[model samples]
Target: MASAPQQSLPLFYNDLQPLSSQQHADFKIRSADKAPFLAKQHAVPVTVEEFPLVQRFMPIVFSQGEEPVPLALMGLNEGINTFFDEDGSLNEPNFYVPAYIRRYPYLLARLRPDSDELSLCFDPTTDTVGAFEEGEALFVNGEPSETTKNILQFNEQFEQAGARTGQFMKELKELDLLIDGEVTIQPDGAAQPFVYRGFMMIDENKLNELRGDQLRKIVQNGMLPLIYAHLFSLGLMRDIFGRQLRQGKMPEPQLVQPTA
Candidate 1:
């Protein structure tokens, strides 16, 4: 049920343009109270560093693919977000917003395929940053302002975390600890259970079957707790289903017949 953007551009970004003081010296980044871009985004790519906090708020699962990336599910189904309203305002306060969302409109990306260096980039479609009269200044006296510096620092940290998350995924694959994920939730008076699939999750059975040294290795390296966090957060699947049901976003039930 969780998938990242496979198109030419990343999720929520329509187009990317490298940020340069020459072209955008007078640009200012406005704080947005609402993020319409997140309204229909059900899953967002997350880093391993976010698992501890992400698990507390939403289920963390892997997208189904050859190179599966960890994703934080905002809703069980596509185009359904339980936490945010249609206007992209939080339905409830004090929610742990993912860094992936918080870093929107700005990201560090390699401008050239041949270059190993990454440049600061932003989505021009977003009104968050532009040549606006009011808001945080992006540059001061032809140099990056404090606001821009902070944004760069945050994006750098995010990239580092992304690398760590990639390593974590690689380790899971090497150990064969990931499996197809499925969740079945049956609400009271429902004719059939809601079966959610199309995602990957930790294979607890395989995890338990690992050799003692293998188990100890992961535990000592801190992967064990993250795995457990993912497993424990799965209980929130039912909670998400309930939210969809209450919000009238639940799709018509698809019943699976018993095999004769």
Candidate 2:
């Protein structure tokens, strides 16, 4: 299994604090009309629960590194998210936003390193969040309000999904199914085809070599569909590459220097 991505605080998270009545009794999470936060992100973390819906629009791929997580590709290259426009607003209004993005500001994190306890915390740096004179109150009369409870429930579910994703990754790794991924594309008038590497993908050849009992166990475990979903989504790589090419977002190919 890919080593878990180095455990670090996610993006936009700074000065996390547990939701407290004394600290944020009158605070509310304002409704934002758009998601400018995701504008610059080319890939976003997702889970098995989201695979069925997410596979339709974006190519689902695993992130490269020790801790490999499922990623929904918004663009073929880094820092290029085709889903959002110049203002960071989503171009496709109907596109399904990943729960990881929707659960922004609120995340379950360990407050202390000494123990394994996790706390529900929010990012104070987000402009959309904070103590407000009005809107939805996080705590009313020193008790969590309905909105707060709902957010907590959603975050819990998200955490659960994360656990399942970890198990899925473990299974893939144990099966030795993941291998280095590469894709080649040729533009209509280009002199040469472009090849992309550095990412990891499921090895179909290895999958085909699994024993009958192994295949039965995987099928019984309900992992077969998820594996198929991942394989099917790879077909969209060309679409994404083309989208970037047509939108003029493709970056210049890297040139390797000769070694002495």
Q: What is the lDDT of residue 114 in candidate 2?
A: 79
Residue 165 lDDT, candidate 2, scale 0-100 = 90
lDDT for position 157 in model 2: 99
Give lDDT tens digits, candidate 1, residues 1-260.
Answer: 21122257777777778888888889999888998988887888889888999898888889887889988888888888899999998896857898888988887887666788888888888978888989999999999999999999999999999899999999999999999888888899988888888889998889989999899999999999999999999998888888888999988653121110
lDDT string for model 2 (55-133, tens) is 8888888877777878888887767778887677888776888899999888888766676776778877777778766
Model 2, residue 6: what's the lDDT?
Answer: 27
Candidate 2 lDDT score at position 95: 83
Question: What lDDT does the true structure give each of the candidates?
Answer: 0.84, 0.79
Q: Estimate each model's TM-score.
A: 0.94, 0.91
Which residue pairs come into collision in candidate 2? 2-66, 3-66, 3-67, 4-66, 4-67, 5-67
